[model samples]
Target chain A: MILTVTLNTALDLTYRVPALTPHTTHRVTDVVERPGGKGLNVARVLAALGHETVVTGFAGGPTGEVLRALLTPLPVRDALVPTAGATRRTVAVADRATGDTTQFNEPGPHICPAEWAAFLDSYETLLGQADAVALCGSLPPGIHVGAYAELIRRSRAAGVPVLLDTSGEPLRRGIAARPDLIKPNADELAQLTGAREPLRATRDARRRGAHAVAASLGADGVLAATPDGTWQATPPAPVRGNPTGAGDSAVAGLLSGLVEDLPWPQRLARAVALATATVLAPAAGEFDAGAYEELLPRVQVATA
Target chain B: MILTVTLNTALDLTYRVPALTPHTTHRVTDVVERPGGKGLNVARVLAALGHETVVTGFAGGPTGEVLRALLTPLPVRDALVPTAGATRRTVAVADRATGDTTQFNEPGPHICPAEWAAFLDSYETLLGQADAVALCGSLPPGIHVGAYAELIRRSRAAGVPVLLDTSGEPLRRGIAARPDLIKPNADELAQLTGAREPLRATRDARRRGAHAVAASLGADGVLAATPDGTWQATPPAPVRGNPTGAGDSAVAGLLSGLVEDLPWPQRLARAVALATATVLAPAAGEFDAGAYEELLPRVQVATA
Candidate 1:
């Protein structure tokens, strides 16, 4: 089983409005909601692709309940720790007239020390049963910045490969523990490597201690650096739709490739193909099996 | 006890972002959720003012649970009938740079036949114990436009005065029941009365079967028409700030005045003062006690 950790989960709300004007009341024509957090999103795509996955993280208040309830019908196993603060909500307002989307994100629940301890207990139990773990998304308040680093170290000690996906300080601090894999988008890679060149950033990330570094470069596709070699995988063409969750889709693809025992180049190819398909999917970050299967063999992978 | 009905309740979310751009991912800086729906808002303000208030409406799913949870801590009584769908969410994105707000409102939950029946039961039970009933907000899907008409007739039959606050077809259908008083903002009144002049429109509204009409005219204050005569209430100055809930606050003021047995002029003055104070208050539509006190004496009610 694969475990995905989301420290900050949210109720992702998408609203369709005629237009967004400052301080104007709007009659949102439509609304759609789903359980969201980086890890939850990854787990969702994994479950949709017929993978056995368990999601763990901190959730609280009514928003937490909304997340849990939303997850009940899905195939993924949920083992979220309850906290005192309400989970955050991210509102995406899509303007019908201009296709403009305005986003408003809420900081997720604050996890107390006791709640973190409880999570540790649950995570340890789950980690013991899991073949691999994926630490994903932003850290909630009251959490030490290096919390992901500790998780990476613990996963290594437990002999389970860990995939680290986060941005900024947490990602910077986490790489020191040397996780099996790190996935950062181009911008995040730049911030980490201070390099404008994608390939140089990939090498910098790998050199920073990760066994391998995978960078998702939007339309340009995936760039991978490993001790064995460096490679770039790009889809033949870009698919269109909501690109939301494409990275998480890539994470799911990476984890799925690892579980399948694929080579680095093959994994890179598969991840890029899956992400491309996800962009084409109606909702962001999900790919249909038929489209994914058709696109996998066509992705172009290049060795450095 | 005063009973307020919110057929479509919501979890109102406010998001503060530096600037909102279209079709791009944004990092939202702040989020806040509060119980919402015109009637629920009115009930909250009434409770804060020490009124024994009961809020009965259709609410369901996890968001509905949150709507109920938010009310649990307040002094108002909850009589939410369960439904199949989650109550809607309204998101307001405030752009700090432009000092503008863009809103995305969700269409409310769809109420099934059984849910409608449940609300009727709750409304009857609460109305039996209440001195007044206020039917507020837009009609949710699956509820007949004339639903408020039935409710208004029931309240009148019980010798209880009802204040109807709504717009469009629901207001059009509800007015036939001759609710003791109807409060429509100038625009709504114009749509209902077909008169460009608000005073003329208000007089037209009273002729359309409403026993009286209280018309809110934004900066111009309020104009009220009764069987006895028409009166105009003006504030000393325009109140500034978010006007989100000012309408509900005015409804609360009117109800308070009626319950206190104040003359119509005094009620109009109180309503105008409260509405002004509410706009200036931190949360739109909620009047701070101090602001209410400061503004009340300054509201001038003159014969029209």
Candidate 2:
């Protein structure tokens, strides 16, 4: 089973309004809530793809309870640790008139030292039974920047392949632990390696310690610089839709391919296909099965 | 004990941001949540005034749990009924830069017939011990528009004074039940009575079956048309801060005076003073005690 960790879980709330105006009152016609965070999103897409996935993270307080309740219906297993601070909520206001969305993200609850220690213990245990682990999303407050690095080291000790997907200091620190793979979008890759070019940035990122670097070029798709070789995957055409959870879907695709022993080219092809499919989906973290099936064979991956 | 019924209770979330722009993302700097609705707001103000208050409403799902947890520290007794649907949330985005607020209010959970019956049963039991009951807020979906009318009748049957605080159809139907008092702001009064003048609107409202009518004239204070006499209470000067809960504080003041058997003029003065004090407070449902005390004697309530 693939294990995904989301330290900063959120109760994602979507409010549908007729219109959105600043400094005015809006009566939301509908509300939809779901469990959210990068890893959870990845787990959801993996579960949809018939992969067994376990989600572990800090889910506490009332929002955590709501998130857990929403997760109960999903196929993924829940191993979320309880914390003192209530989980945060992210509100996305969808304007029905203009088809625009305004998002308000609340900083998650602060995790105390004891809570972090407890999470470490729980995470280590989950890592031991996992075939592969994906560390996702931003580190919540009270967690050190080296948290991903510590987790990557623990995963290495457990003899499991680890995929680190994050940005800024966490990504930089986690890469130093030499995780099997790291997925950084164009901006994050540039910020980390200060390389204006994706190819150079991917190589710089790998030199920092990662065995492989996958750079997502948005509409262009995935570019991988692995120990085996370098390959660039491109979609059939640009897919325009809400791109909120497209990257998470790509990570799930890559992780699924890794566990299935697919070649780097085939994996990149699947990642690109899934990312495009996710972009076509109505909401974040969800992809249309038909779209994924249709686009799977159409993606092109070539040696760079 | 005073019983406050908030049929449509909400988890009131306040998000503080530097500025607000439509269709963009906002990182909320601070989050403050409290159990809220018209009745809950009134109950909070009453609790602060050292009154023994009981709050009853439909509070179910995770947001309800969060609202309940927040209410635990307050002096009000929780007698909320459980429902199948999750409670709603009302988000207020306070722009620190412009001092403007954008509000998004979720339509509350649908209350099925069984849930409504359960709430009524609970309400009657509470009314047996209540000296006065305030029926507040809108009716959630699946509940009848005459809900307040039914509740007001029940409170009268139990020999308890009832204050109906709402607007539109529910308020119109509730007034027909001859509630002990009805407090309508300028807009709501004009909507209900079709009278632009406060005195004419208050008189029309009382004729519609409310035993007494109290009109909140915003910064001008409260005007009361009661069985005793008609009086207009004006503050020393217009107090300004957050007027979110100023009306609720006025309701609390009126209820407190009613229970204490204060004369109509004294009650109007107290309500006006408390309303002004609440406007000076930093947050909703909170009043400056010092300001309330200082303004009480200074408020002018003359026969009109």
Candidate 3:
């Protein structure tokens, strides 16, 4: 079973308004809510791919309860620890006329020292039974920046491969723990390694400690640098749509391939195809199965 | 004890952002939540004034649980009935730079027929021991538009004085039921009576069967027409501030005066004073007691 960790889970609320004006009242015509956070998104995509996935994180307060309830119908297993503070809610107000969205992200609940210790205990237990673990999303307040690093070390010690997906200091710190795989979008890759070139950044990231690095180049596709060799995977054509959960889909593809013992190039091709398909889906983190199947054969991977 | 009915209760969330712009992401600097609805606001103010107030309406789902938890700290007694759907949330994003607010109100939870019936039974039981009942806010979906009318009749049958505070057709229907008192702001009164002038609209609303009509004229204060006489109560000066819960404060004043058997002019003066004081307070539904006390003696009430 795959284990995904979302340290800062959220109750994602999307509100559709006729138009969003800076200082006016909007009667939200529609509201759609989903359990959200990077790892949860990855878990959802993995579950859709028929993978057994368990999600572990802090889920507390009313928002946490709502998030848990939303997760109930999904195939992903919930292994969330309860915290005192309520889980955060991210509100996205979409303008129906302009097709523009204004986002308000609440800082997630503060995890107390004891809660963090409890989570470490729970995560270690989950790691024991996991084939692979994906650590995703931002560290909630009160969590140390070395959180992902600690998790990676523990997963490595448990003889389980760990995939790290985060940005800024946490990603930098976690990279030093030498996770088996790391996926960073172009910007995050550049920020971490200070390399403007995608291939160079991916290589620098790998040199820093990651065993492998997959750098997402948005519509251009992905640049992967691994122990075997470096490869570039490009989609048949640029897929234009909401790119919200495309990265998570890519992560799901890579994890599935890794567990299946596919070659690096084949894994890179699958990741690029799945991400492009995700962009074509109506909502984030959800990909059309037909689109994924059709795009799979069209993805081209070549050594860089 | 005063009973306040919030047919459509909400979890009012206030988010503070540095600035508000369309199609931009905002990191909310602060969040404040309170139990909200017209009736809940009234109950809060009534409780602050040392009145024993009971709040009843639909409180369900996770949001309702949060609202109930919030209510636990307040003096108002919670007698809310459970519903299948979760209570809605109203988000107010306040721009710190401009002090302008952008509001997004979610359509409240759908109330099933069984839930409505349960609420009616609960309301009738509470009315039996109430000095006065205030029917406030919009009816949630699945509830009849004539809900206030039915509630007014029931309160009358129980010999409990009922105050109706709402707008549009619900206000018109409830007025026709001959509620003991009806408070309509300038727009609501105009909508109900088709009269732009406050005094004219108040008189027309009274003619429609409201025993008393209290018209809130925004900065100009309240104009009241009662069975005893007609009076206009004006604040010392136009109070300028957030007017979010000013109306609810006025309702609290009116209810307090009614139970104390104060004359129409005195009740109008108290209502006007409390509303102005609420405007000066930092948050909605909260009044500066010092300001209320200082303004009470200065409020001018004259025969209309």
Candidate 4:
């Protein structure tokens, strides 16, 4: 089973507004809530692809309860470690006319030292049963930025191929422990490597000790570099849509491919197809099965 | 004990950011949540003033649970009628640089006939033991605009004064029930009475069956028009601050004055003091005791 850990979980809410004007009041026409965090998003896509997945994270209070309740209907197992602080909420305001979005993100709950110790115990127990692990999202307050690095090292000791998907100082520190894979978007990659070019950034990320570096280049597609070689797989064409969770879908594709031992070319192809499909889907991190099938064979995988 | 009924309760969340740029992502520096509805705001203020308050209305689903959880630590008692749909959430983006605020309001849960009846039953039971009832905020989905009218009529029958605080269709319908007191901001009074002049509008509102219309004139102070006469109560000068929930605080002031058996002029004076205090206080619907004391007695009341 694939285990995903989200240290900071959120109740993601979407609001559809005709327009978003700053310093003004707006009445949202519709609203939807989702179980959200980078790891949760990855787990959701994996589950949708028929992978056995377990989601373990720190969740507490009412927002945590709602997150758990929302997950009950999904095809994912949850073993959330309870804490005292309420989970954070992320809000997205979609403008119907201009098709733009305004996002407001709340930093997740603060975790005391005792809570972190409890999470470590829970993680160690879950790692023993899981074949692979994916650690994602920002670390909450009171937890050190090197927290992901410690978890990565623990997962490695268990002989599990860990996938680390995060940004900023967490990613910088986590890369030193050399997780099996690290996924960073172009902007994040540039920040981490000081390389504006995707290929240069991916190579720099690999040198930083990540065994494999997958750089997401929004419309251009995924640029992946490993010890074996480098490859760039571009989708059939850019499909214009809300591309909020496309990167996470690509992570799911890459991780699921690794789990199945698929060839890197095939893995790149799958990742591109999934990322493109995610954009076509109306909601975040969702894709149409039919579109995914059509795009899979058309994805071009070439040496980087 | 004071009973505050919030027909459309919300999970009120505030996000603080350095600046706000539309269609872009923002990293909120701080987050705060509170149980919000007009009556809930009133209850919070009253609770801070050491009043034993009971908050009742329709609260349901996960959001409702979160709302209840947030209010648990407060001094107010919650006795919400459960329903199938989740309660709404309100998000506000406060820009630290400009100190501007952008608000997004969600449509609240839909109340079924059974739930509506349940709410009525609960409200009546609570009113039987209360000094007064404050029916505030917008009507929820599937509930009639005249819902406040029914409650006002019932409160009168129970020999309890009702403070009806709402606007638009609900306010229009509710005024016909002749609530003992109705508080309308200048804009609301304008909408209800269509008089450009504040005094004329308050008089017109009183003529339309509101026993009295406490018209909030923003920085200009509050004008109270009773069946017998009209009086304008102005604080020494405008208290400088963000006046978000000043109106709700005014309602609290009026209720507090009525409970203390203050005459109309004295009540107006207290309201101006409290409203000014609320404007000075950092929290919505709350006034610091020091501010209230300093502002009171300094307010000048002129009767016509």
Q: Docking category for candidate 4?
A: high
Cα error of candidate 1 at position A208, Å: 1.7
* Candidate 3 lDDT by residue in tens digits, B1-304: 9999998999999999999988888988889998999999999889888999999999988889989999998899999999989899999999897678999999988998889989988887898889999999888889888889999999999999999999888988888899999999999999998899888889999999999999898888999999899999999998668888999999999999999898888888889989999999988668889999999989999889
lDDT of 4 at B208: 91
Better of 1 and 4 by DockQ: 4
lDDT of 2 by residue, B145-253 (tens): 9999998888898899999999999999999999999999999999998999889989999999999999999988888999988999999997658888889989999
Query: Residue-wise lDDT of candidate 4 within B1-304, one digit each (tens)?
Result: 9898888999888889999999999989998777888888888878776788898988888788888888899899998889899889898889987768899999998898999998889888988998988888888899987999999999999999989999999999999999999999988999998898998898899889899889888787889988657898998986667677788888888887777777888888888888898888876556778988888888999985
Q: Name every residue pair that clashes in candidate 2.
A: none
Residue A83, candidate 2: C-alpha displacement in angstroms? 2.2
Chain B of candidate 3 vs. true chain B, TM: 0.98
Off by over 4 Å in 2: none
Worst 10 residues of 2 chain B by lDDT: B237-246
Candidate 1: lDDT of B83? 88
Q: Residue by residue across A1-304, what tens digits does model 2's lDDT show?
A: 9999999999998899999988889999988888999999999989988899999989988778889988999999999999999888999998997668899999999999999999999988887789999999988888999999999999999999999999999999999999999999999999999997999999999999999999999998999999899999999998778888899999999999999999999899999999999989887668988999999999988887
Q: What is the lDDT of residue A19 in candidate 3?
A: 90
What lDDT would candidate 3 get against the real structure? 0.92
Task: Estimate how well candidate 2 is docked, as a DockQ score.
Answer: 0.80
Pick the DockQ winner. 4
lDDT at position B223, candidate 1: 92
What is the per-residue lDDT of model 4 for residues A1-304, given as tens digits with 9 covering 90 to 100? Answer: 8999999999899999999999999999989899898889989989988999999989988889989999999999998899899888899899988779999888888899999999999999999998889998889888999999999999999999999999999999999999999989998999999999889889999999999998889889999998779999999887898898898899899999999989888988888899899999988778778899999999999998
Off by over 4 Å in 3: none
Candidate DockQ scores, in order:
0.64, 0.80, 0.79, 0.84
Question: What are the chain A TM-scores for all the models, listed individually?
Answer: 0.97, 0.97, 0.98, 0.98
lDDT of 1 by residue, B1-304 (tens): 9999989888887777778776666777777778999999899888887899998888888888888888889899898888898888877777767556776668888888887887787777777798888999988889998999999998988888999999999999899989999999988998998998988899899889999999988878889999878999998987667777878888998998898888999898888887888878876446778988988899988998
Candidate 3 clashing pairs? none
lDDT of each: 0.87, 0.92, 0.92, 0.89
